[model samples]
Target chain A: MLVRFWGTRGSIPKAMRAEVVRSKVIAALVAADGRRFDSETAVARFVDEELEMPVAGTYGGATSCVEVDGGEGDFLVCDMGSGFREFGIDAARRMAEGHSKTFNIFMSHMHWDHIMGFPFFGPSFDPEVKIRFFGGHDDLEEALRRQQEEISFPVPFEWLKANIEFNKVVPGETVEVGGYQVSTVKQYHSHDSYGYRFEAGGKSLVYSTDSEHKDDDPESEDMFVEFFRDADLVIFDTMYSLLDAWTIKQDWGHSSNVVAVDLCSRAGAHRVAMFHHEPIHDDADIHRVHTETIRYEELIGRNSRLEVLCAYDGMEVAL
Target chain B: MELKQETRERALIVAPNGVIDHDSAPAFEEQLHKVLKSADDGALSLIIDMKDIEYMSTVGLRVLMRVSKRAREASVDIKVAGMNACMCEIFKISRFDKVMQVFDTVDAALAG
Candidate 1:
């Protein structure tokens, strides 16, 4: 299963964000000599100028969408955010191979960012495409319609002419979609959220976003943690930093990179792509967080058996 | 698949081991609840020895969770003994360390 980053930026759009594209960019420039973080200034330079990507600010297009398939034509996605625009285009291309393509999309919640790209999803806009939407909200259709409401946007819900289906799933229930065993659990957030796990092709992927961490109730905690155990990949919420998430954004309906890292480590996930980048973070800042999150994982001894990657726009994973 | 019980002083020792799994979780829980309820009536403490245990699935952990909740509700404390690393890892990952007390040896658990 090959994984690629389509839209890695978080929150908002950014240019010059791909400021420092990869560790090699920093390694070739700052740390070519293979030395550890020597001084505060050196670490600061690496943090600031190291992994910057080509984007403007945190608005590096906060399109959160990812597709997992092995080019065998099985498409499973997690969200319909602005990123879906690009995913839709690629999905259309895949449809070239076969007509009546099947698409399964799991929305974390009714949040705008998670479903903003619904109407524009290429296949959904196409008459030959079939799209199945899954989430834990009862009013799934109304929630989706809110995005295309005349007041919110020029286009109305009736404008989309694609074949679309929606299911209102409850947390802790399991359903099979597109040959994948799909199960969900309730996640803490402003609007109730769902953390879903899909097992197929002898691999598993868990999507947990917009979930706020709470230690007060054991049952809630167990429901969240036990729901995603031993996941092969977990795309999780990382909308804030630790300081902001706990002291300030506490109970604000999002998680920090620290929380995401902890979840990946504790759940023994093989890969963790941090999701829900804060809109305030510029391209450079988001890249910095991504790089620093790796360092922080090492310090916290949570890096074992977990590969950390930032999700990028237009990226595809051959799973 | 069944629960056996004994008593020493105020501590009532309960043992339920042997092929515990998700399928038998309900039985395990019921037996555990019966023992704890019996202890709550008079016994000062409850000790569960899982030495003969071979396996535990999610359902097994569910049983443990129910017992912990039961302990909290009745104020009848529980001590677990003879946990293997695999079981310990599951408990640790679930953050059960903060919720339930665990020990390495039955002697240590009993003494505590």
Candidate 2:
């Protein structure tokens, strides 16, 4: 199984501001100093090795949307955030190249940021495509339909040409979808979010976001550890600083990198992809958060092999 | 956990000593709501004095946010006083300072 991140930001979509990009460019130029690159390869090497990650790379601004490839017949995706638009375009390109036009979208919840991309999803307008939506909420269809009302959007949900289906899943019930075993667990959030676990090809991946971990209740903590137990990868919501999450942002339904590291370590998860980045955090801020999380993990003396990854747009992880 | 309640002027003061963490937040919340219920009909404000509070976790903060919302709706003022430097920093970062008034001392809170 392989995981591809189309979008990683949370709350709202944001584009890199011109000033932010200009700062990165200026920083790169200053680091280059008197050096002159003879070719594109040399410049690329400088950016990769000499420049800091924040200056050379980006933790994209798209919200949610991840694709899980289990080598199956249909496309399996999680969340239809703004990133879905880009993923839909790519899927359309694949369909143009003789691939099947089936998409299975597993929703974490119907928050505006998570479902905002559906109307822009290109394949939904295609007559030959089949789109299936899965979630724990029985109001899944109504929520999606309401988002496309005439007042909110130019395209009505009824006008969509694709054959669409909504599947309501109960927590802890495993379902077979495109040869992958998928399960969900209720999470603590304002609107009742869910964390999904997918197992296929001898690997397990858990996508858990928009959930807050108070770490005060032993039973709830144990349940989360069990849900994440021995998974290959755990995609977590690390949207705030530990201090913030524990203090002012309490019950705001977001966790911090420190909590993720602690939880992943306890669960014995092999790897953790820090995800659902706070929209207000800049590239430098995210890089610092990721760096601090790695350092915190090392300090805790967990499994030496446990890996930490900061999820970015277009990043692909193979399991 | 020790909780002390006092009535000062038009404000009801609740002072919690020791850690206001997950284990203690629920009890604290219950006590607070009980006091609020008794003071609901009056035009009294709510003041949380954190002079002896050693630590407060997210669970503790949730209780405050909930109370703050209710206080706003009821036109009741909520003030946090006697927070140590560390607690003050936490409040600022969480933006709780914007939602409620914070004072350096209980006297200052009462005066305000």
Candidate 3:
């Protein structure tokens, strides 16, 4: 199984400002110390070895779309955020190269950010392609259709040429979809989001975003730990700090990196990716949060071997 | 977890020792709530002295937060003081420093 992050930003899409890019360039040049690279390989090596991730590359601006390739058959997509547009283009190219045209998409919720890319999905206009949407909400079709209403978008849902279908997934029931056993769990959110767990070929990956973990809710935490138990990779929403999540941002439908690490460590998951980064955070701020999360994991990971990863746009993990 | 309770300057001081983690959080919560209950009866303020606390996990922090919320509801002024370097870092990284009123010392918390 392979997992790819097309977008990792939360709340909304946040493009990197020109000044931020200029600062990164200045920082990189300062680190280079006026030394000239003989080859592209040398420059790559310098970027890899000398500069940190924030100074080298961006975490990106796209919001919450992850592609989980099961290595054969139909492609499974987690969300349809703005990043889905890029994923759709690449997927269309793959289909043109004779790849599968069937798409099995798992919708976390109908939040605008999670479904905003549907209008731009290139394959949606293709008559030969088949798209299946699976979600815990019964209003999945209605939500999609409403988003494509004439007042909202120029394109109407009925005008789409693709053969689209929607299936409501019952929570706690594992259903086979796209050559994998997929299960959904109800999450705490304003409109009630659902987290999906996928298992195939003895590998497990849990996609859990836009969910809030209450500071004092032990029962809910235990349920989440069970949902994340012994997974190879858990993509989690680390969109807020503990202070914000507990104080001003309570009930905002997001979790913190500290909670992610704690839950993943408790569940004995091998690796946890911090996904759905706070939109207000710059690349440097995200890097700092990731660094702090790693340190927190070390502090709390007594007898637990959990690897912490910060999910960036275009990151791929294979299991 | 063992909590030492005392009253000083019309404020109730509850000092917790050792690690406040998953195993000890319930006890800490119970003792802290009891202190909050007592403070609501008479004390003008409540101070959690963490000078002897070696570590605090997420659960422990949650317990503190719940207690703080209860204190606020009860109209009792609650403050935290005397965290070690590691605890301070934990608060800083978790952003709990902004959530709660933290002081360098018990005297500072009392004075401020």
Candidate 4:
């Protein structure tokens, strides 16, 4: 299974501000410190090795879109956040290359940020495409349709030429789609959300975002631990600090990296990816959070083999 | 969570100690409702003294937003005071600061 992140930011989409780019450039220049590079390769090496990741790279600004390639002819996507635009264009290119134009979109919830990219998804307008949306929400169809209403959007939902289907999934029930087995669990979030687990080719991947874990709910925590057990990769929502999540952000429906580390360690997952970054947080803040989460994992001394990676747009992890 | 209420010069001061989270938000909301229920019915002003509050979450923020909206409909003024730097940052990032006035001290909230 190959997992790719199209967007990682939570709440809303944002671009790096001019000042932020300026600061990174300044930091890179300072790190260079009168050293002259003769070629672009040397500059690339300096950016990759000499400067910190936050100073050289970005987590990107797209919101909540992930693609899981299961070696199947069809496409499998999780959430259609603003990042879907890029995915759609890529799919169109693939279609032009004589590939199947079927899309299986697994929605966590119908929050605006999650579905905002659907209207702009180019494939939906292509008559050759077939799109299937799966979710646990009863009002899933209505919610999607409402967003494309004439009052809210210029295009009507009915105007889409693709063959569209809505599948209402019940919690704990596994569905075989293409070559993967997909399962979902109810999550704690405003208006409720669902976490999906995908299994294919003897490899497992879990996509769980916009869900908060409560300390008082030990049973639920244990359930989640079981839900994520022995997965190759677990993409988790780490949108706030432990201090923030536990204190003032309680019931905010988002978990912290601290909780993610503990859960993944207990679940014996191969790797945990910190995801759904806070929009207000800059790359430096995210780097700090990622570092602190790793430190917290070591502090607990649960399992030294558990891997941690911060999810960034355009990053791909294969299992 | 412990709530201490004091009526000072036509302003109702609500002081909540400890963390305001999922488990405690309901109790916090209930306490505020009780105070509002008992207050004289002309025009109301509330000053939330958060000096002793160590933490808060979006659930707690929702309670504040809900209560503030109700207060607004009733022509009441809601102000917050004594938020720690962390709490202030959360409020600012969440944009809750735009909905209510925040002050460093109770006197400042009351005066403003």
Candidate 5:
């Protein structure tokens, strides 16, 4: 499995906000256990060694694109943000070089930040590539269609040459696409949003992109506990500060790292990728968030054998 | 885990108002099956007062789905009402929603 992050900024994209310039915070990643980079010195070394150009979060960037392929391999990327444009180029180059045929793009919601990168996704331009898009909204087709609405697009949805399969499933319904077992639960957002749990090649990965965790309520807590149960990896939407989550952005659809780290440990997830970085946050803020998140996670009692990580553009994890 | 049958006309409304777990699942299933059989006199409907049931399990689903299947086969009506969200997800998972017509009130079930 190869998980890569092309973008990490949350809310809307900001370019000049110092946070955007020094954007060393990586709230997204690609997952494949090619190697482990856990220590700060190790990460610094990798950023200095592996990446030709160290990329960080930029406003109007992509969230995360994970390409998992082994037994029943998959090219499923979550959120079609600006980062997806780069991933799309990668996939397109792979396709040009004869990489894979079918690609499944799963969207957490149709929010602008999550959808802005679609027009730039290069695979959609390829005649031979197929894109299977999945999401939970009242009308999945309309959401996809609206993306190509001519008010903004030069071509219509019908004019697309590439086959884009839209799968709209009800909550609790499980769908097996190719060899991947995709289980979904309606997550907490103001309107309808979906959180996906993917099980493939004996590995379980849960993507909770945009969710709000109000652990004060027992029902909400139980619902989360039930949804996560036991899992290996969790990509969570930790887009707000604890102060913002509890105060300013009270009902906004995102979690704080406190909620993210705590929920990951509680749900027995082995690792967590803290994603959907707030646009105002820079690299130092990320380090601080990590410290604060670990503090809150410790307050929940230390039974959790969990790994927490920050993501940035072009970061990859092999598991 | 006791058999508490409350009769409504010829219809037998088995109101097993508690959490149906392993400790109580068999008794609940058996007793409900009996009530369903006795209500086979072609009553208009067989109602399960799920109003008081705080929780229902996969084992409990065995009872509901069986009764629903039998009632459908016998040409007698079977319906459940007043389920909370927790129990509703159980039905949604088993896809019991499409098979059984659920309502919020007994009158609505009887009327349907």
Candidate 6:
């Protein structure tokens, strides 16, 4: 299976400011010294080899849409954050290339950031397309419809041309969708969120975000460990530092990178992708946190090898 | 988890040796709770000396936080001292340092 990150930011959409862009450019120039590259390939090589990610590129600002490819029949997606607009456009082009017009969407929760891109999603306006939404919330359809009400958006939910179906998934029950066996686990969030585990062929993937793991909750920790056990890649919420998560940001429904590595390591998961980037963190801050999480894993990942990958927009990992 | 307790004129000091982790955090918590419950009216302060602690995880930190809250409700002062570098970093990163007073030595904690 292949997992693709279209948007990785959490809470809200964040765009890079001019000053931030200029700073990156200046940093790159300084790193390059006075050397002038003769070819595009050489410049690409320099950027790839010489400059770090924070200086060379960005960790994008689009909120939480991820696509799971390599499945049969239909397209599968997790969340529909602002990135879904772009995903929808691309899906349209893929359909022109003989791809299926069916979409299977898994919603973690209906917070504004998670569903904001739905209004701009191109496939929703296509009469021939079919969409299926699966989530743990009973009000999944209600939340989507409320967002599209006349006062909030230009288009009404009833006017959407696609045939959309909402299916409520109960925790601990396995359901087959798009040829993958999927299970949901309740998560701790404001209105509650759900984490998903998808198994296909011999590989497994877990999508767990917007969840807080309190220090006092051993039962919750064990439940999450079991949910994440032996997965190929687990997309986790790493939006806060250990200091922030347990202190000022306690009970805020987001977790830290330290907790992510600790939990994933205990589960024996092969790898983890730090998802839901904190909106306030710039590329450098994210990189620093990512580096710290790796070091933390090395410190506590006893008897296990866990690869930590920081999620970025348009990143793809094949398992 | 082995906890050694000493009673001073105005304080009860509990020192835990070995690692405080998932397996031992419960016992560590229970022992601290026991000390708090049995303290005389004269023993108004609680000192946790971490001189011998090898390591601590999130669970152990939680125990300390819970104990601190309990101590506060009982109108007892709580202080931590003698943490090694690793333990200090853990405390700092989790901001447990901000939750309660921390000292370099037990003597300094007692003096304060």
Which prediction has the highest lDDT against the true structure? 3
**Residue A220: error of model 3 in Å?**
1.5
User: Which of the CAPRI classes, incorrect, acceptable, medium or high, describes model 1?
Assistant: incorrect
Give the lDDT ranking, best first.
Answer: 3, 6, 4, 2, 1, 5
Contacts from the true interface found in each model, as a fraction, amount to 0.00, 0.00, 0.86, 0.00, 0.00, 0.29
What tens digits encode model 5's per-residue C-alpha lDDT throughout A1-319?
Answer: 5566777777666455555443433422332136677898987776556543324332233454445444334577777766777777777767666667688877778776778777777667667878888887766667667877889787667776678888776678889875778888787786767888888767787878778876345467566766676777788888876445654576887787756765676688877888888877655566566555554454443566677767666666665
lDDT digits (tens) for residues A85-122 of candidate 3: 99999999999988999999999999999999999998
In CAPRI terms, where does candidate 6 land?
acceptable
lDDT tens digits by residue: candidate 2, A75-130: 99999899999999998998898877888889999999899989999999899999
lDDT (CA) per prediction? 0.69, 0.86, 0.93, 0.87, 0.68, 0.91
**Residue A85 alpha-carbon offset, candidate 6, angstroms:** 1.0
Quick one: best TM-score, which candidate?
A: 3
Worst 10 contiguous positions by lDDT, candidate 3 chain A: A297-306
TM-score of model 3 relative to the true fold?
A: 0.96
In the range A105-184, model 1's lDDT, one tens digit per residue, is: 78777667777777777676667667778888878789888888888888787877777888777666789877778898
lDDT (C-alpha) at residue B103 in model 5: 82
Better of 2 and 3 by lDDT: 3
DockQ each candidate and list the results: 0.03, 0.06, 0.82, 0.04, 0.01, 0.41
The pairs that clash in candidate 6 are none
Quality of model 4 by C-alpha lDDT: 0.87
Tens digit of lDDT per residue, candidate 4, span A163-212?
Answer: 99999888899999878899999999999999999998899999999999
- By DockQ, who's the top model here? 3
Looking at candidate 4 chain A, the ten consecutive residues that score lowest on lDDT are: A295-304
- Writing each residue's lDDT as its tens digit, candidate 4 over B1-112 gives 8889888878888899998876899899988777665553635588899999887765577678777767777777888999987677666644566667999999998889
RMSD of 4: 8.1
Per-residue accuracy of model 6 over A70-115 as CA lDDT, tens digit each: 7457999999999999999999999988899999999999999999
Sorting all predicted structures by TM-score, with the top scorer first, yields 3, 6, 2, 4, 5, 1
